[model samples]
Target: MKEKATLIVVGTPTKILDSYEKQHAPFTKYKFHLSKVYKGDGEEGTEIELLQDGNKDASYNVHPLMEVGEKYILFLERSSTGALIMVGGPAAKYKYNKEEKVFESIDGGRIDEHLERK
Candidate 1:
């Protein structure tokens, strides 16, 4: 049940902030500058926020991918409030090198194909 995901997007993380929910539970919010939409609406130029539960003790397997200004291929799941959050923790995150045109997985594997560009 860890690998469940529905949407994928390639974008640069522009900003991040730590915030709390109603009961003071911490969560991280990431704002992304979308470049390529791989599985959802292919609209670019819009910024979107991805939120993840930050309480490690009872988190939804949320891992930190908080490198602002870095490009990433992110696997996400939509919340009831229309926000997107990382899915499957670190496994759903991939660093994208625009210079070399490659996607590097969290486990250090280079993924060059099986992802639709544009």
Candidate 2:
């Protein structure tokens, strides 16, 4: 099934917690500082967290670690608590290629193609 994404933005990751030593918890998390608003109400420079970790075997849906200072286009949804987060695991995250002026999917293409009607 296709997951619904309500928000889309270009932002930079401020921090990440994939190991137990960092967040003091078992789940992996990413904190992003929004830079560009694309499809949601996220304000520029505001921070949001993306959480999606459970156990060692649950890595299939996990988002890869984002590099600090690297801008990315994020497809997101609001959680019940009203926090912004990745809408469909790795499928919702894309890296912004500054020189190319395009959002490159983690799987190596533009997300627009997959999102459009065929």
Q: lDDT at 118 for candidate 2?
A: 14
TM-score of 1: 0.69
Off by over 4 Å in 2: 1-3, 17-26, 52-63, 80-83, 111-118
The candidate that wins on lDDT is: 1
lDDT, residue 114, model 1: 54
Provide TM-scores for the models: 0.69, 0.65
Task: Compute the lDDT for candidate 2.
Answer: 0.64
In candidate 1, position 22 carries an lDDT of 44
Candidate 2 lDDT over residue span 6-116, tens digit each: 767777878774533324434456788887776666788798777644424334434555567887777788778675657766777777776666667667756432343
Best by TM-score: 1
Q: Give the count of colliding residue pairs in each prediction.
A: 0, 0
